[model samples]
Target: MLVAFSLAPSGAPTDSVHDAVAAAVRVVRESGLPNHTDSMFTTIEGDWDEVFAVVKAAADAVGAFGSRVSLVLKADIRPGYSGELTAKLDRLEAAMEQSDDPA
Candidate 1:
């Protein structure tokens, strides 16, 4: 599961990205997911459904920080179970390739 997150302060980026990442980690941990990063976003792989819930929880926590949280969740949505939503650039690539095909 992936949660793309970005933080903006009132006047400037007062809080280092590290701090944001740490808080995000705590949030994810509270929701009970393993393995989080301190970069552009956080990604945790687990029972897809639970991961989705945790993503929301993490977002909520970030919002509580007073920083504008910008995130576009990417995950698969199956009939009842939501799966991991990575990048869909592959689909676009395929479409472009077909368009360029001689046939």
Candidate 2:
């Protein structure tokens, strides 16, 4: 499973959310699961329980900073699929490279 999620503290005490975002990312990174974080979301690859545990912990971490937390998530759950995280992107890149169109 690949779980892509974004967690943040809404109405936080500070204007900059860097601290809270960092806290949430830290939880995901420290989980030692295969993961990637971009400007929009952090994608984690793991079993259902492991992935949910990290997401829960990350949300809880951010929730500490404000009265409300915002969590947005999208998941691709393939019971027997593994490594689709990298493989999916790799396939896309391969297809792109094979394209005849040029700008």
Candidate 3:
């Protein structure tokens, strides 16, 4: 399973969300799962239970800093598939390089 999620504190007392984002990202980084974090989202790949647990913890971390919390999640549940995170992109790049067709 691959999950890309964004968590942040809504109704925050201040404009800067770095603290809240850092807190949530801390949870993901410590989860021992293969993961990556970009500006908008953090993507994690792991078993269902482990991934959901990390998400829950991350949300909890964000909730601590604000009156309301927001979580946005997108998941690709490709059963029997693993390492699609990097593999998919690798395949696309390979195809692009090999193609002789003019763009």
Candidate 4:
């Protein structure tokens, strides 16, 4: 399974939430799960319970930064697949390359 999530804090004193976001990303990274973080979301790959535990911990980390936290989560639950984090992108790039070739 792959979970992509974004966590942030509201009612924070500062306009920038980078620190809070960093806290969340730190939790994800420390989990030692297969993961990637881009500007918009952090994606993690693992079994359901383990992945969600990390997400919950990350949300708790962000909560310390403000009175309220907002979490957006999306999941792709494929029972038999792993390493889709980079594999999916590789497949997309391959398709793009194929399409670029002339008939």
| Highest lDDT model number | 4
Q: Candidate 1: list runs displaced more than 4 Å.
A: 1-17, 76-103
lDDT of each: 0.57, 0.93, 0.91, 0.96
Clashes of each: 2, 0, 0, 0
Residue range with the least summed lDDT across 10 consecutive positions in model 2:
94-103
Model 2 steric clash pairs? none
Best by TM-score: 4
- What's every prediction's RMSD, in angstroms? 5.8, 2.2, 1.9, 0.7
lDDT: worst 10-residue window of model 1: 3-12
12-97: candidate 4 lDDT, tens digit per residue: 99979999999999999999999999999999999999999999999999999999999999999999999999999999999999
In terms of TM-score, how similar is model 4 to the real structure?
Answer: 0.97
Judged by lDDT against the true structure, how good is candidate 1?
0.57
Candidate 1 TM-score versus the reference: 0.49
- Candidate 1, 1-103: lDDT as tens digits: 4444443323224654455546667877677555445546566656656776776666665666555775655543344322333334466788899999999
Higher-lDDT candidate of 2 and 3: 2
* Candidate that beats the other on TM-score, 2 or 3, i.e. the better one: 2
Between prediction 3 and prediction 4, the one with superior TM-score is 4
Better of 1 and 2 by lDDT: 2
TM-score of 2: 0.92
Question: How many clashes (backbone atoms < 3 Å, residues ≥3 apart in a chain or on different chains) does model 1 have?
Answer: 2
Error of 1 at 34 (Å): 2.9
